[model samples]
Target: MILKTKITLALALMVSPVMSSFATTFTKEFERSDGIHKVKIDIYEESNADTKNSKITASEYVKDKKVWSLVDYVNKCPLDINMALIKDSFEIKKINGSFDAVLFSYTIGCVGGLDPVTVKYFAYENGMKHSLRGEERMVTPDGVIDDNVKPVPDANLKNNVLLFKYMTSNWNKASTVILE
Candidate 1:
C-alpha cells in the first residue's frame, strides 16, 4: 500500500497545467500476428500527460520483485537500469502514429518474465490503437552514472524527468505540472 501510494503521489506532482478540456477516458486493445496475443492499454485522449514541460528527471531503481515483475528474464537482463523522459518516448508514442509502439521497445531477446513484453509498436486498426510488445522491449538502458561513488547500475532511474518528481510523494502531488 505504501509503495502504491508513493507511486501515485509521485505521479501527481509532474503536472504542467490542469487541462479541463479532455475529460473523456477510454481503453483500446490490440492484437499480435504471431498467432495469439492481445494487448489492452488504458488510453486517455488528450491527457494532461500530453501537455507539459519538464526539466526534472525522475528515476527509480528496478530490483527484486519490482524489477522481476517488469521483465521475467530478470536473471540474464543486460541492462542494469532504464529511463525515458516524461514526454519523450512515452508521450510521442501516444501523440504520433508515426512509429509503432512495439518497435520502440528498449529490450529485446531477453525472455521469460511474468508477461512477455510487447510494447514497442502500435498499429491503428478498427478505430483503436493496438500494439504488441515485441521481443525488443526495454525498461531503460544499460549505462553509467558517475555519482562520484561506486557506480552501480540501476534500472528505471529517470533523470530530471519532471519538477515535482524530485520531492517526496506527498509533496509531489502538490506540485501540479504546469505548461509554463
Candidate 2:
C-alpha cells in the first residue's frame, strides 16, 4: 500500500550510525523523589558494529535498593542504525491519586516498512517497582507516535481505558485498545 511505502521511506531516512567502534556501550540514569518514595532508573544500551544489532536494558531501584531489572528491547537492524533515547521523556505520574509511577519513553527506527521510530513508553510503579503496564510493554502501539494521538485528562476515564487515534493523510480513525 502507499501508506506502507511512505512509512518505509521515512524510516530509512532516519537511520544513522551514532558511533564507530566494534561495540558501543552507554548508560543513562534518571532519579525521582517525593521526600518519602525515591526511585532511580538506569538504562543501558549496547550495539554491535558487525551485526548491526542493539540491546537495551533497564534497572529500577526503590529507596536505593534494586527492585527490578529487564532487557527492555532488542533491535536487529540489517543495516547500520542508531536508537536514540529521548532524554527528556522520563516523567513521574500519579495514578488515580493512589501511588506515583514512572514513565520512560524512547524511539527506534529501521528500514523496510517498520514502526518508523515511534515513541515507546515503559511505565513502572512504586515499592517493588513492578511495571504499571506489565513487563516491557509500550503505552502506544506500532505506528502510533506522539503525533497520532492526544492524551486528554478526564476524571471519569477508567484506569483500564486506552483510547487511540490514527491520523493519516487520507483519513482519521479512533479506537479503544483491547490489551493483549
The top-ranked prediction according to lDDT is 2
Give the whole-model CA lDDT for all candidates, comma-separated: 0.25, 0.42
Residue range 31-143, candidate 2, lDDT tens digits = 55543333444343445443455555666554567655656544566664435445544556665356555555454445444233433445555543322221111335443
Weakest 10 consecutive residues of candidate 1 by summed lDDT: 60-69
TM-score for candidate 2, residues paired by index: 0.44
How do the residues 3-41 of candidate 1 rate in per-residue lDDT, one tens digit apiece? 999988778866444443222122222333322222222
lDDT of model 2, residue 179: 29
